[model samples]
Target: MHVVVNAATSADGKLSSRRREQIAISGEKDFARVDRLRADSDAVVVGVGTVLADDPSLTVKDEQLCERRREQGDPEQPARIVVDSTGRTPTDAAIVDDAASTYVCLSEAAPVDRRMDLADRAELVTAGEDRVDLLRAFAALEAAGLERIMVEGGGELIFSLFEAGLVDELRVFVGPTVIGGRDAPTLADGDGFVAEFPTLTLESLERVDDGALLIWRADG
Candidate 1:
């Protein structure tokens, strides 16, 4: 299965501020396109911050969009997964409430008791020491029969996967806004990880509506 990173960025290249604020907000077309991408994927993966900030339903909406999904071979819906190293995923988060299937990846640092609680609502998986492991998580999802894994990330998650070379493709939607936040984050791995995507290369770039969507492929 190919792991795909799909995210929206501002014209200025900021995902969100350090305080976890929204920037580079997408227009209706981009928003709908994102949803369509979710629908077309076998699973939708996101970081814990996005869950807390966006509270996205992760389900394909819009009558026309839903119809298009059916044409694309997408059935009911795709599974939703969240990477929460501390097992900090809110029990009442909409992703858990709405997704037909959900998985929460917690780190070994989390207490065994907490794992039980998370497992009751969503399947609990362990990765890394105190941070989620991008390679392990993606491999597990791939083993579970997900051929197309879509990552909708907060900064840290995106950076980790890219740096680890787990990302097989990248689809960036560039919006027409510059929300300048000094603390805004664009994926951070606090342990000072160096990016080593030595074989990844861009495949194509196209202007989609109000913004440009850049596509890249995992190269050998």
Candidate 2:
């Protein structure tokens, strides 16, 4: 399966404020651009942190796009997957709606009540012992027939996937604003690499409004 990471960040690379609040980094044009990417993919994945912060609908909003997918004999909407180790995504979250198939990946340590509560709303997959194992989750997603996956993130999840060398491409929409804070979230968080780190090759650049959209590929 092909794994792609997508994010919109500030000029200083912060995804959001220090307290993890959601910020509007992308403009309307960028939103449409990302919606197109979502419409083109087989599945869209995000961490639970994003869910709690943004409460995203996680579906393609354009009716024309949905019609096009239908005409092509594809699902009207791509499957939604959440890497939620603790099963913290509320059962009533937008992702639990019937707009698309929802899959919640969890660790063995996920709460039983939460798991049971979500059973009817989403497909629960145990992927790791204590945290959601991205590799295992990817394999399960592939097995479920989602080969082209897009990851829309909230820092920690992006870091884990990229650090695992699983991302084939990273598409970042850099906005003009800067909200700098020592505890602010960046593109790749967690215990970042110290040596022998992975590198990215700039693949493309396109300016939009006051910012630019950059695409980088994982170095071979």
Candidate 3:
């Protein structure tokens, strides 16, 4: 399976404010590019923190793009996957709507009631004991035919994917704005790597709506 991570960050390398509020860092052109990326992927993945913070639909928004996907014998929108260790995803979250198939990755430690409730709306995949094991969760996704997975993350999830050596590519849109805060979420936010940091090969760089788009391929 191919895992591609995409994010939009301020010039200061912050994904959002320190308060974890969602902000508009990218412009219209970047939004369109993200829509296209969603339309082309088999599934979109995010962490539970993102769900609680932004509550994004994670569906392709362009009608034309949906049509194109349909013509290619694909679903109107890609599947949505959420990595929630303890099943904190709200039952009414947009990702669980009928617009697309939804999968919530949970751990065995999740409350039975919450798991049952979410199971009514979204498929539940148990991977770890205390936390959602990304490796096992992704393996299950791959077995379900979700080969092209796009990760639209908060920060911790992104770091976990890199730490697990599961990320294949990364595409970042560096917007013109500067959101500066010591506690602000950056592109990858987990325990900082001390040694053996992930390496990347620059694939392409281009100017997009008042911003720059940078693409990199993970080096093994």
Candidate 4:
């Protein structure tokens, strides 16, 4: 299974401003690019923090992409997967509004009631004890026939995935603007790596509307 990380950040490396809410770092062209990526993947992954902050629909919005997927015998939209360690994703979030199949990945620490509450609306998978073990999450996702996964993240999820060494490809959009607050979220947010930091080989770079798109493959 291939795990791809996709993120758009300011030139200063912040995903959002000091407000820590959903910020538009990508332009319409970037959004269309993301929709194409979503159409190419079997599942789209994100963390609960993204749900709380952005309330994204996580669906492929381009009509042509939808048609292309359908022609290829794929679902019109990729399955929406949320890494909610404690199962706090709201039932009313846009991801759970019946527009697509949704899965809530939880930790064993999540309350039974929370599990039950989400059972009807979305499938639940427990991946770890105190937190969502991303490695196990990958196995479960692959087992469920979602072989290609695209992770659209908040910083914590990005750090967790990179820390686990699970990322195979990374696509980053560097917007021309800057959100430089010290507390602003970046591409990755977590404790520093205990040992060697992972590296990537630049695969491609292209100019987008008012920014640049960089794609990298994890260096072995």
- Best by the lDDT measure: 3
* Better structure of 1 and 4 per TM-score: 4
- Ten consecutive residues with minimal summed lDDT in candidate 1? 188-197
lDDT of 4 by residue, 90-154 (tens): 98899987888999999999999999989988989898999999899889889999999999998
What is the per-residue lDDT of model 2 for residues 32-115, given as tens digits with 9 covering 90 to 100?
999999999999999999999889888999999999999999999999999999999999899989999999999999989999
Q: Who wins the TM-score comparison?
A: 3
Please list the Cα RMSD from the true structure of every candidate, rounded to 1 decimal place: 2.6, 1.0, 0.6, 0.9
lDDT of 1: 0.77
Pull out the clashing pairs in model 2: none
lDDT for each residue of candidate 3 in 65-127, tens digit (9 for 90 to 100): 999999999999999999999989999999999999999999999999999999999989999
Q: List where candidate 2 sits over 4 angstroms from the true fold.
A: none
Between prediction 3 and prediction 4, the one with superior TM-score is 3
How high is the CA lDDT of each candidate model?
Answer: 0.77, 0.92, 0.96, 0.92
Model 1, span 73-105: residue lDDT tens: 765678888989987777788888744688888
lDDT accuracy of residue 176 in candidate 1: 75
Models ranked on lDDT: 3, 2, 4, 1
